[model samples]
Target: MSKLKFFVFVLFMIISVSEIRSQIVINEIMYAPLDANNEWFEIYNNGITPVNLQNWKWKDATSTIRTITTQSIILSANSYLIICQDSNKLKIQFPGINGIISTNFMECPE
Candidate 1:
């Protein structure tokens, strides 16, 4: 209500927001069905902030795993992040029961 109180409140909000940390959460995981040339994994950032995926990775039932340190990616505030076997050729499959969820925009080759 008072000037001092408002300033304190604003400062607290800024600090609290900035202090928050983002966790790399795997919201969904699936294998591409189109020809199965490569597998893909989807990650979601369910935090109130953003995160850099420079040194990220993923694993499955097998011993073979994946690391995304070379990939330059940053998940938005509230969006799904895609990781494909072939970043240049393969398409990012959305979290779907099958292959009926992705927009197929990047699926088609130019």
Candidate 2:
């Protein structure tokens, strides 16, 4: 009887973890060497559905913000965005009905 209870508990934990994965899809990631001078990162969501960025995290050698809140952007499927400390250098890739995607780089401030 005890063995059967243990098997059921293990199965339940496995199923619970699997459900969480379907919600968030980390589509793409880019890392620029900051060398403690600057901190920046870009995370794209390629999920078929829109996900609220609230409570999501981006981490580096320095800090972590609880969320990415900029213009309340919503990334549609197959689209991408740039999240960085220096938005001035790289133009953010936003989705139009039809447009060419583009990006550039910023030299880290010394």
Task: List TM-scores for all candidates, in order.
Answer: 0.50, 0.44
Which has the greatest TM-score? 1
Give candidates' CA RMSD values in order.
Answer: 10.7, 8.2
Task: Check candidate 1 and list the clashing pairs.
Answer: none
Error of 1 at 73 (Å): 2.2
- The list of candidate 1 runs beyond 4 A from truth reads 1-22, 32-34, 87-110
Span of ten consecutive residues with least summed lDDT in model 2: 97-106
Q: lDDT by residue for model 1 over 9-92, one digit each (tens)? A: 999998875654435566665565565545556667777667776545444445445465444556667667666555434434
Best by lDDT: 1
Measured by TM-score, how close is model 1 to the native structure? Answer: 0.50
Give Cα-based local distance difference scores for all models: 0.54, 0.47
The alpha-carbon root-mean-square deviation between model 1 and the true structure, to one decimal in Å, is 10.7
